[model samples]
Target: MRTTNRPASGTVQSVDRAVTILELLAVHGTAGVTQLARELGVHKSTASRLVAALERRRLVEQVEDRGHYRLGVGVLKLAGATTARLDLAQEARPVCRRLAADTGETVNLAVLSGGAVLYVDQVSGTSTLSSYNWVGQHIPIHASSNGKVLVSELDGTELTRMLGELVAYTPSTVTDRALLEDELAQVRQRGFAVATDELDVGLTAVAAPVRDAHGDVVASVSVSGPSFRFDEARIAEILPLVRTATTEISSRLAHVPPER
Candidate 1:
């Protein structure tokens, strides 16, 4: 019979300890269980269990059958993900700047993460009444234009699973799952999305999908401004520019157009 030696605290503690072990290995090249236990100020048994879990995940590996552990391929995999995100932000910066200049409204690049919209980059437009900086902020998926465009990529079942209950942020916010589905359907057909006084009473935004090399919707490009300034006529004028910016960014990401 095999007994599992789980961490005493919980998942969060286990993760923290695991990351610390990785950091120790990074600084020292390789470390034995006793050395890692001393560095972590935990029991040797605890360190051994944590290292075992990491090894199973391919995040750590031993030099031999019973030797010191070192970082593994999983670390490189995580590093690659971070590098890709940085590249995405770098590639989208110039495009967002151009969109902000062309539309005279704040431009943002956002991606869907954990059922919410995560703003990764932004460029403020030439306006005295500038909207607040939203980079590194997470907003609800049901209330923002960028969120709508991002969610439009998910199928019905996956969409429903992701958005359990549509929480309303403002009076105009769509809280009904069925209605939100309908709106996403329209977003798919129109190739863009609009949110006016939805997330905030006086905010308005328009967004288009940004695709990756495989044509997957990886992110969205949004132009946002005060509601009064983004009335129907103004939105009509700026929509094309926003779409063009998204297309340019997607092209930079190596998205090839489907052959007609």
Candidate 2:
């Protein structure tokens, strides 16, 4: 017998309002009911109802002033929960280590989370100048090689929604949305990406996409270091090696799929 999946039907207005309240708090740092109602274009009573529901879930908390709300500790808890089980961090560690050892440059494994590229794994290089490990760090999508390669997979609307306003991380980061679109187009055509001091001064990275059996990009593998050693020529030299390592890791992941 065949079964049909029924579409959900419920009062999603409250949910939407709650999300709006969260977004407003994230953007404004804190807000009172009146401000939230105005931002959401909803009635004061409706905003109050939404805030009440969110308060019950610990997603939002009333500030000490009694009239304002801000994001609660529950959001941190939820974020931590995701950080604890980032699968790429676990699966890519050894691969990254091998790549770093072979290339004598820092190797990174990153996944797109929210609007940023989350560095879940890093293997330090042999260079003494290569700074601290970057595990659990986030880099902007338009300012990192891995981020650009990952962003290349997204549709235009989804990409715009993900990047949102394109705050410049550094002077070199592409802040113009149209220019970034053109850059992403180039990344797709090139099959890899290079970022020179876009995220930080004197830092450079070369990244290639890791694809699954279905040939869809799942993560990125990158080699990153200071500009003194990771120049344009050096990045071009290592691009093939990074791409090779990415293919190996993707094959391993496809053969031994991680258990959910």
Candidate 3:
């Protein structure tokens, strides 16, 4: 609750405090009531109430045999809910299954939300040793194949705002805004994207954009796995399959728009 030099709007202030609390726990590992209150510039009772509210929602938890607190399972549930609420998940399930069966690699459905790609559904391939379980997680919009495919839908100004101060998630992640913008333009022209070890050290993914009836990019369909099984040639091979899956999903989605 530190006062901003320029006062924040009410909504912005609430969001800032919520994000600050999360950052505090991430950086300090564990914090007690008084210390957190002091750090946040709020009263001890107010901090306690915030902690108690977070605890009730499983976003924070009290440490055992200690007065400190840490992040809890509720955060994971909240993260998972992003995917669970998507109408695309139900509509795209059969298409994802077909893609997984054909490619023998995990098939994922993702949509762009708040400048990040949120996985809405996934179907695990029947490989002898499969990899990746990021179905209900958020990944950087500039670092993944699905991300680039979705980012292609944004206009120049909106894309620039979303890509502000990009962080490198991996050695190959494009943190340079100009370079990433160029790549996004290519993705727009090509109708697909291939990311090799851009997010994880040895992960590769091929994604195609999913468009609605009006031709707006609504989501992305991807096939992904470990680098050992997803090399350049393999990614190129799967691109067509991913495109086909996305096409099918798009056709199904065209008939059913979300209720406003």
Best by lDDT: 1
lDDT, residue 96, model 1 = 91
Highest TM-score: which candidate?
1
lDDT of 1 by residue, 81-169 (tens): 87887899999999899888888789999988788899999899887364688988999998999999998979888888777688878
**TM-score against truth, every candidate:** 0.90, 0.65, 0.65
List clashing residue pairs in candidate 1. Answer: none
Residue 162, candidate 2: Cα error in Å is: 0.5
Once fitted onto the true fold, the runs of candidate 3 whose alpha carbons sit more than 4 angstroms away are: 1-85, 128-130, 255-260
Candidate 1: TM-score? 0.90
lDDT of each: 0.89, 0.81, 0.82
Q: What is residue 89's positional error in candidate 1, in angstroms? A: 0.8
Q: List the residue pairs that clash in candidate 3.
A: none
